[model samples]
Target: MFTEISADEHDRQLELHGPLTAAVRRLVEAGISTGADSETIRQAQLAVEAIAETLEQQRHDGPRTMRHAVTGRPVVLADPVIGVRNAIAPPLTVQHTESGRCWTEFTLGAPYEGPPGRVHGGICALVLDHILGEVASDGLRQPRFTGTLTLKYLRATPLGRLRAEAWVERIEGIKAFARGQILDDEGVTVEAEGIFIAPAWAREAG
Candidate 1:
């Protein structure tokens, strides 16, 4: 089941309490103390990663998500799509919905820091792709996945909390077009364009 953790708790674990580093240290200690097989140590380490991922999801202020960190398997709960919807960094939450369009909002935090208190470019891509894909999936019998993406970093996205939004712009046959933007308290920092495609397998499934 999915559970939420307060922002304070997340900070304590990731920053103050140092749960992640502590876990890795423990794995090293175990290896030295017991000379355990490499596989055993790896499995234990994987479990720790799972726990951390689950906790991170609980802390994100977006759609709820949970997964087996070790196997990268979704922890099925309310809706199957909910986990995917929430797993992306700065996970998004639906703010508005209507025919041919969907809207969402979310925040980014220190955990996503790239270069001394700024959001990473890869993370920015993840945010844009998720929202664009979500909007593109709205009316299609077969949902879309990113086929190509183009981005422009107009300015640096500051660390701490920030807002982002995306919407579908057009659709032609199996291709979908979408645009997205990231903003801090100051204003817009990044813009994106994406091309999404409905895969043949998905069409068959639908």
Candidate 2:
């Protein structure tokens, strides 16, 4: 996985010592000197970057976590499940919670850029599966594995920052049904459903 650095860190570094190298300053100055259009473009980009950095810094905790039944909360798992949970844990860049439902909020950066600067649909599915599965089992404790996942892209999810919510709809014997949605500030961009299996090992352990 790539190490995520907050935009605020970039801004803080910029402010604390100014542009570290003359190269950056030179680039900006050159852009400014080129023409009005260039200056306008540069300023616009810089302002956006500055805002992103500031927001990222302010949300240093990463994603926000929510515990709501509608969102499917994660069950507390034991042993190896605990280890995996910890290892694959969402970045401080994203929030996570395991109550009746499970949810986490975080921003994706250039690394996750699929279509230009927007988040890819497949990535959204990946998140939905994990979150929905976790909620299916209630978290580390119950530990449900993904048997099937279906995602519908209602709209393109932007790359910068995003919010996601997931929860279990119901459970039938060994199978758990779950659903989730991803949203930008505007509204929902992706909706998903998942069928998770509670492995025999996990069930036995529990």
What TM-score fits each model?
0.57, 0.55
Quote the RMSD, in angstroms, for model 1: 11.7
Q: Show model 2 residue runs off by greater than 4 Å.
A: 1-99
Estimate the TM-score for candidate 2. 0.55
lDDT per residue for candidate 1 within 23-124, as digits (tens), equals 544544454457668898788779878987987886545433343434333232223222222222243454535555555556555556688778888887
lDDT for predicted candidate 2 compared with the true structure: 0.61
Of candidate 1, the 10-residue stretch with the lowest lDDT total is 80-89
Instruction: Give Cα distance to truth, residue 118, candidate 2, Å.
Output: 0.8
Full-model lDDT, candidate 1: 0.63
- Across residues 1-206, which tens digit of lDDT does each residue of candidate 2 receive? 12334455434533643322333334444543455676788787898589658756863343222222333432221111121122222231223453587677776654445888687667777677666766776663466788999988988898767777888788898899989988889999999998989888777876
**Whole-model lDDT values for every prediction:** 0.63, 0.61
